[model samples]
Target: MSAVMITRKVRKWEKLPGKNTFCCDGRVMMARQKGVFYLTLFLIVGTCSLFFAFECPYLAVHLSPTIPVFAIVLFLFVLAMLLRTSFSDPGVLPRALQEEATFIEMEIEAANGNVPAGQRPPPRIRNVQINNQIVKLKYCYTCKIFRPPRASHCSICDNCVDRFDHHCPWVGNCVGKRNYRYFYLFTLSLSLLTIYIFTFDIVHVVMRSVDNGFLNTLKETPGTVLEVLVCFFTLWSVVGLTGFHTYLLSLNQTTNEDIKGSWSGKNRVQNPYSHKNIIKNCCEVLCGPTYPSVLDRRGLTQEDLPVPVASAAPSSSSSSSSPVPQTTHAVLCLQKTKAPLIPNKRTPDDAKPSIAASAQKSPSPKEENPPAPKAPPLASPEMDVETSINKDKTH
Candidate 1:
């Protein structure tokens, strides 16, 4: 229950309810924290409208034309958006898991120098490219390596993300490797909240317009100015975001995906997530426990891997398979061989060489050996010399 303990625990699939399934797609939740203001505003509108309906017959009669229907519709719309945020394909787990290995590889490359054991060299980023454009890709000076597409660094969290998504201020956390699902739900709920409140305000405005002359309506309605302002803000934001998200979703992409030119026609074949039944594949990603690697090894049960197309067969130049190898055994072998020795833990079978290296650094009797002198230590040069001189004088 403690914060430290909570941090240590990996939330369980079932017990960890409330957007536990989707962690990779940060924007799935949308803008829950930033847009919560509209939810509050809508609640106020609903409350006030109800009050007027009961207290003042004239006001109620005028407001009745639009208030109830508007309130109900708006409420439902907001509710739908909130609910949509929570729903996602649980099937993407396999793909996500597969990509995780590559991410780990990148981390490994960063840690140990590139040089092999006993060599004077270190491993370096082999190839680097920056597109020619005024909009320079944000660089990570700390990591000192060009990030792959969809990757970014969060200033607040101080870690580079694989796919940079918008930051949510409400959670006071970045929707990074761990917390993406919660963020998606947050945005979905907020959009609904905005739509609902906007609807309610619109109805209330219309009803007021009918009750009083158009010019007088402004004076008659309570909080008319506030209502108008909130309504404009909500409609503009919700409409714009919903439209943009629809396009991204249809293309089987996230905000990060869209920005990185992952869908650019020039490299369409190279995009790992591209394939037929993409919607189904993406749904699985959102809902499933295991995710595919970027290499497209289906993380689901073996039965779930997509069958290749026969008629729409890729051109001989294109392979329908993932751009990366399913499992890079070569890299794995190198990693196994290169693992660092941890103190106090039993050395792994692969780390025998590392242990031997340490052993070689210690002093041994053979290494300490020195040439022996022929004479004994007590047989000093001074004694020998004095004896020889006394012998000569005696003679």
Candidate 2:
């Protein structure tokens, strides 16, 4: 049989089997499923446009020339921060290679002392000390590696993310170690921007209302009413999230850990990752060195090197699951089960062997006074069947 076909497909981003969406040759990455992210973009752009066109021009003239300048700065900064949060990598850990996976399996085997074949395996959690505090790392079946500290498998992205905070659909990406700073700053800047737009919209109306009357001001600038409505509804959630993240930042806890009560629970557990000082915690999270993206999305994958996935011993890990088998093996069990068996061809001349065997087994009557019955010598099942067929033919 021919060997399994090895196809080379480009795009390291799409080459990954993880459940993520990649764009711009992996420049832009996001969860496969995004919620309200477009709505967020739409609301920000629409509200800003209305402010610039209707509110900003009037405010720039009467209120202050800096009003439009400051608003533009806020608008541009908010966009830059939002894109940084949404499009950037979220500190995803690459799936373990075969060598790494084998090494880990060996370590597991040494610790577990070999679980007998066909028996239930032990739980895949391992405990290690960090800052003198014990942290249990759970094995990810998908990634085929025990996650590092503060790493968790994101169900949405189907990738293990380091310092996983939460999968924010609003950002269409995971809030993780790499981009959490951007997300936090996005929220912070956005709250200020929202408040700024809201405040100025009212100010514009009041300044106009002094001469034109409040009801007339509302009617004249319809965009002001719309902007106020958008900002008013958006203000609480944006400000609320900013405050919440600020609190979380001070404690140096992730949204994931916070929700799970990792530190705040009645278990009296302390957060080992926390510096204990608020300023230090904030500085560590906000001003810490940024981690480079793990996705080599733009790299070219030469597929044939890794394509001989078929091995004598099949791996149960997800990465090697359903691997195409190789042609050579100690056993052809897979081939035997899957390929149709060839049938043996028989001719009428083939019956001669059975007749000859019967003749050899039956002694001539002339050679003995009485024909003696003799036991047959040991023979294979095929020989026995031939003898039976020969006897039936003679009878």
Candidate 3:
């Protein structure tokens, strides 16, 4: 059937003998590693800028004091833009999501009325309260078991992902358990770099204000004006971006979720990915040891699981729509029924009657004759009666 295969309760990070690493070969790790390359570029630009602006007076005549700052800012902005692009189109990876199971339940529905003895029904997703907050859970259809919070099926990767974040093209990987914090850090640092450069150049330009006289004197200042243009552009971008990320951080959202339109009224309370403590969560996701691992995961128990008893068959308290073990919702489904096909018969209204007979039967409208007009009255004495009588006599 080309159905995927899965190993239950086995995590993504567990080490088997002779394996080199316990990780998805996805780009999240690689892109995060590449961020260092950008950092190095920033440093090199900073050195050059400093030498031109301060150390070398000869170059200072051509470059502004904030040139180094401008360079750093420009580099950061380009890096951020590239990263954003990368995040937008992440490639595929080979991995499976994992979660802990605390309870078990099973239900079955016949496929084409051919029942398999003791075969479990398909898994359903559910919502549950964890540590006083609601998080979603799901069943892994391939594994025939329920999965825990933050688990997802990666179609490209062809398996469920634990703590699943969206795939990013910039990192060329899925932003899940591990590289989430690094993603945030990359955005923040880029924003700061842009703002710093913008502020410095703006101040410098204003200080060097020239008299217009009869011509625009600002053009007299020498060399490439790219620095000024770059500064203004970065200023607008950084200010807007910083404001946006601050809000997302407060609400604990990813760029991927923001664009994917996943937020709901219940997101604040029901979101499993929100930081338990904003600061602590950021630390864990960014630079801490808390990346999502298939191994060492936890999940919900069976006693609290909600089983959707069929309304038609209420005595079967655990119906085919029972929630998966670690998840919080039922996998709702419609029962399939096949009815015998019957050919449609034409009614009197639908039948084609004689068109000529219908046309001849229609009533015709009757025509009425018009009445003749009355003659005009003769000319009176109050008018020019003599002239009227003369004219009538001539006629």
- TM-scores of the candidates are 0.40, 0.73, 0.42
Candidate 3 per-residue lDDT, tens place, 255-339, comes to: 5466555555544334455665778555545556653333331232223224444345464565755656533332221112222
lDDT of 3 at 323: 52
- What tens-digit string does per-residue lDDT give for candidate 1 at 250-358? 4555676566565575745344443446576546435545332231221322122244444544666465463646378678775555543433335476778767776
Ranking under TM-score, best-scoring first? Answer: 2, 3, 1
**Against the true structure, what is every candidate's RMSD?**
28.2, 19.5, 28.4
Error of 2 at 300 (Å): 2.1
* Candidate 1 vs 3: which has more TM-score: 3
User: Considering lDDT, where higher is better, how would the candidates rank from best to worst?
Assistant: 2, 1, 3
Runs in model 3 lying further than 4 Å from the true structure: 1-123, 126-129, 132-134, 139-148, 153-161, 170-172, 207-224, 234-238, 255-263, 266-287, 290-395
Considering every candidate listed, which one attains the maximal TM-score? 2
lDDT per model, in order?
Answer: 0.48, 0.87, 0.47
**What digit string (tens of lDDT, one per residue) describes model 2 on residues 1-395?**
22566667576776787888888878888887766889899999999999999988898888789999999999999999999999999999999988999999888888888678899989888899999999999999889999998999999888999999999999889999999999999999999999999999999999999999999999999999999999999999999999999999999999999889988789889999989899999999999998888778787776653334454553556546765556544257544433322223343566766656655666454556866687776576887899999999999
| Ten-residue stretch with the least lDDT total in model 3 | 333-342
Who is ahead in TM-score, 1 or 2?
2
